[model samples]
Target: MSGAAAAAPVRRLAVIGCGLMGGSFARALRARGLLQQAVGVARSAEARARAVALGVVDEATDDPAAAARGADVVLLAVPVAATEATLRALAPALADDALLMDVGSTKADVVAAARAALDAARLARFVPAHPIAGKEKAGVEHACAELYRGAQVIVTPLPETAADAQRRAQALWEAVGARVRTMTPQAHDAALAAVSHLPHLLAFAAVHALAQQPDGARFLELAGPGFRDFTRIAASDPDVWRDILHANAAEVRAQAAAFRAALDAFEAALAEPARLRLLIDEASRVRRAWAPAGAPPSP
Candidate 1:
């Protein structure tokens, strides 16, 4: 099918988690008039109630099966660890031709779990996805419809993934104003380990290490915009990051090693005045040159 023909409009969407990402996706869909109706599934009654109250979905239910029934698209937004369970619960209710997608940070594990949990006949409809955009702050309270504007969304299609399903998945994200890009599951995971996961780990570590210092409170009080900017991602949900790190352990471990070696090199340079000056100047020049123009002024 042609790309346009492959991506039929999504009439109804089911979001499996009513947290920040899921909530944002629902809101974005509504803003763009992409879905005739949206249903939400949360594990707790309170979460379900909140999702409905927030108007992120037309209906909210604690039962995944009920929420997923008859959905044209099902977006799995739960934590990576909870993905398999959620998929299993929704499997029986999912429409035979529904497009199934996810927003998990890591891909390999989630894709494998989906293969195991979903029915073999419906495997072709599963389009694994990850949106490369989010703030450190999470939860529905922090969710906004414009969160994904101009963001790069990675779509990972497995051997079993159908062309139509992939196209629909891409259109879903594009409807929310994101630029979709295709990547292999391996490449996506490896690239994210270096650019996304590793930075989060370092930010968390930096904040933790600083907090452990005797004068940390005083130091923090004096911290300027630089410190706040650097530590922003550290404020992300610990539970989510834990799942992401463990899910992509091998890649994360390698990234951590490479980061440590870079840190060591910088530390060694500090003892040599000329080398330190050279490193600082080079970093400044590169950063200034690459910085985006017309970007919002950093706070």
Candidate 2:
């Protein structure tokens, strides 16, 4: 892992997707004076218009291929399922020396997609990345320049990834006020499955289970802060999360099973007061100890 200081500005950045992650990236770089111009691509003309109006990019287009042409850097922030298709479309338009990266939640699938979509020459310039930051809120409307500040951005480069490509990806994220770390795609997928994917599944399940009851609306009316905070991620865009979860299904299932086993143990402990107390004490201690003095818990 390495930290990046501000460096020379990128001549042009083509941001595909132009939604939360992509919009934030462009805005952050612009704020830091590290970007000269940015072209944004979105599925809808309305979204493209909004991105430009919000200053997320200097220009906006519905055609990703046209946007990618002559770009110094190409960022694919589209849904995980659409990554391969996006890469394929951008291949012909890609500058010979363009740096390619992504903000997809799952790394393995994105890496695989890039490998399948690009020729060896283009693959060498591509570096897979995931910025571990987001809000429950969705869309380009919520994007802000400070979103990546103090955030952790994981760069998972393949064995064949060029050394210069890896360095450029790291430096770009760092210039936008992020801490960069490197990991293998497989390791990145497994870790994210446990910490991110499984928790989202749990949140969605909690909300869905409640909504299926006869008194669902009544329960929701009586819900408090704990319920709200715990299930906030359930409000995330279903379409986006569906693509991510399915792309990394195997690891997600394994992590979900592990989580279920822990829940079962906790339920069984409820029958024994002493055992339940011990479980509570252990969880409390661990959670409390996770934070250093005068610091808040990590996201």
Candidate 3:
């Protein structure tokens, strides 16, 4: 933990985006008495007002730079597509010693954004992070202090990252009851593409396929627990998913190709009952042996 993490409260924290991820982070830090002030940036007037009303922030504004002024720490929680723009807008307003972090799902792209927007000093203080936490519900209205409790948070440090910034970022997540891990940006992106991105793509496509059928509505109406469980991620915010899928398009596409090959194998084995049964049995074994870790399946 950094001195600031265990000593006096951090001076101020700026939450950019002020949506579910950003709001929950601010709420958790406030609940833990880790920060003195919370300022939020959002384009929607209603969202800004709601953030203040929900105690997600002490004040809110639409200007990203204004929100970042005097902030000792800043959490960039915007969608991946907006990361560079948000960082560019706030870079000049950040304090000399401010520690910057993010909750973006993709790390490689975010690191690239930071490099493009931040100067040498600001870039050194930037520690790209991804918290494997959230709910099906969206918006600041659903934000709560417990959203990150027992969750997994991954931080990818750049080659020039400052020591204090790294310490402060980890301590902040720890204060909020999250388990933190370290990974290179590229490694983080590749792994998440396989497990997280691939699964989400499959979910969305599966639901889309079903909906395209002639009796789509009736089929959905009669869907059982199995179908509902498999398609749950399809309920994720479409705009958010669109940005994510596009941002990591290459990896997602590769994973999709891999899935197609697996499907082809299954189809080819259909004529041989013994081979089909063996394939199913192998899959069942993998699932049975697997156990999710504390929060993010050991990621």
- lDDT string for model 1 (11-123, tens) is 88898888899889988877766668889888788877888888888888888899889998888998899989889999999889988999999999999899889887688
Ranking by lDDT: 2, 3, 1
lDDT of 3 by residue, 173-281 (tens): 8888788899998888888899889999999889899899999999888889898778878889887788888988899889889989999999999999999999999
Show where candidate 1 strays beyond 4 Å: 1-8, 291-299
lDDT of 2 by residue, 36-66 (tens): 9999999898998999998899999988899
List candidate 2 stretches off by more than 4 Å: 1-5, 291-299
Weakest ten-residue segment in model 3 by summed lDDT: 1-10
Kindly indicate the candidate among 2 and 3 with the higher lDDT: 2
TM-score of each: 0.93, 0.95, 0.94
Candidate 3 local lDDT, residue 218: 93
Model 1, residue pairs in steric clash: none
